[model samples]
Target: MKILVCVKRVIDYNVKVRVKADQSDVDLTNVKMALNPFCEIAVEEAVRLKEQGKADEVVVVSIGPKAVQEQLRTALALGADRAIQIETEAAPEALNTAKLLAKVVEQEQPGLVLMGKQSIDSDNNQTGQMLAALIGAPQATFAYSLELDAEQVVVTREVDGGLKTLALKLPAVVTTDLRLNEPRYVKLPDIMKAKKKPLAVETPDGLGVALKQHQTVLKVEAPGQRQAGIRVDSVDALLDKLKNEAKVI
Candidate 1:
């Protein structure tokens, strides 16, 4: 089986995100970029399947400017057999991205598709489902545990109540959750090896995907500073505060 994994480049989780001075979008000037953590987990899972002899190859793909190649290489270093970059001036919104991926899916025709539940930067959590919808493929989202057989994949996913399990046949899409598996650290030698891995670049136009803008960002703002709590003398005082000052009642 050939697994195709979608990855993204985003600001490192350790770095503090800043809203642009003009409130247009997140400020990404000179920030350290890394693979999306959830996407990393997806890559790890795909690589693990290949390592276990269940999968014959793992191909990683990303969409964005040339800079996204950095994250593609990182995925290669982590064990993806090859990488494909769908070059765009900027990352498209979720649906457009799904369209591009759907085209790639048609071209590659992999047995399974994997990606993060959401990109940390956008937190949209919509791509996987959209891709599945576009391609008319069975989908399992927020999967933390997965088992594969000759024709179907069993996925255990987290739900608000607890967990839900589903069986999806081959040629399906699965979005991974954090608990799926811990990603392995990349060594220097692997990083060096990744440089030589085949990295192909294609444009959205080349894929016959005409990008469309479906939404516009009105503004981007940092979250408000949290207010400090004050001590209450008793339950009565808390109740009074809730009823009046805090206005809960």
Candidate 2:
């Protein structure tokens, strides 16, 4: 089976985010960029499926400016057979990104589609479901474990109360959770080999996906500094503070 995985470029999780001075958006000037951690997990899962002989090919794709190809190459290094970049000047919102991915899904027609539950930069967990909706495919989100057969895939997902399992037929979409699997570290040999892998670039217009703006960010701000905690002498003092100064009561 051919497995298609979606990856994303974002500020490295280790980097501290800084809001723009004008509060227009988060300041990205010269920030360190890396593949989204969850997306890396998706790529790792795809590669594992291939290694296990459950999949014939693993293809990775990303959406963004040319810079996104770096993350695509990273996926290739992680063992994807090929990479595709849906080139866009600015990062598109979730729905538009889903639309673009739907086009690719139509073209690639892979047996399975995989992606992260959410992108850390936006924390918008909408793309996978939206892509499934646009493509009319069965979807399982927040999958922590997956079992696959010729015709269907069984997914175990985490829920607030416990875990939920579902079986989805082929040509389905699955969003991976952190527990899916630990991603393997890329080796130097693999990194060198990834440079030789085929990397195709396509545009939204070429894919017939018209970009549309559905929401606007009025402003962006950093969270306010956390207040220091006060020590209470006893439970009564804590109760008094909660009932009065903190106004919990």
Give each model a TM-score.
0.92, 0.93
What would you estimate as the lDDT of candidate 1?
Answer: 0.95
Q: Write the per-residue lDDT of candidate 2 for residues 1-249, one digit (tens) a residue.
A: 999999899999999999999999999999999999999999999999999999999999999999999999999999999999999998899999999999999999999999999999999999999999999999999998999878999999988888999999899999999999999999999999999999999999999988999999999999999999989999999999999999988
Superposed by TM-score, candidate 2 places the C-alpha of residue 184 at a distance from the truth, in angstroms, of 0.5
Predicted candidate 1 versus true structure: per-residue lDDT over 1-249, tens digit per residue: 999999999899999998988999898999999999999999999999999999999999999999999999999999999999999999899999999999999999999999999999999999999999999999999997999867999999988999999999989999999999999999999999999999999999999999998998899998898999999999999999999999988
Q: State which candidate has the highest TM-score.
A: 2
Worst 10 residues of 2 by lDDT: 141-150
- After superposition, candidate 2 runs with Cα above 4 Å error: 230-249
- Model-by-model lDDT, in order? 0.95, 0.95
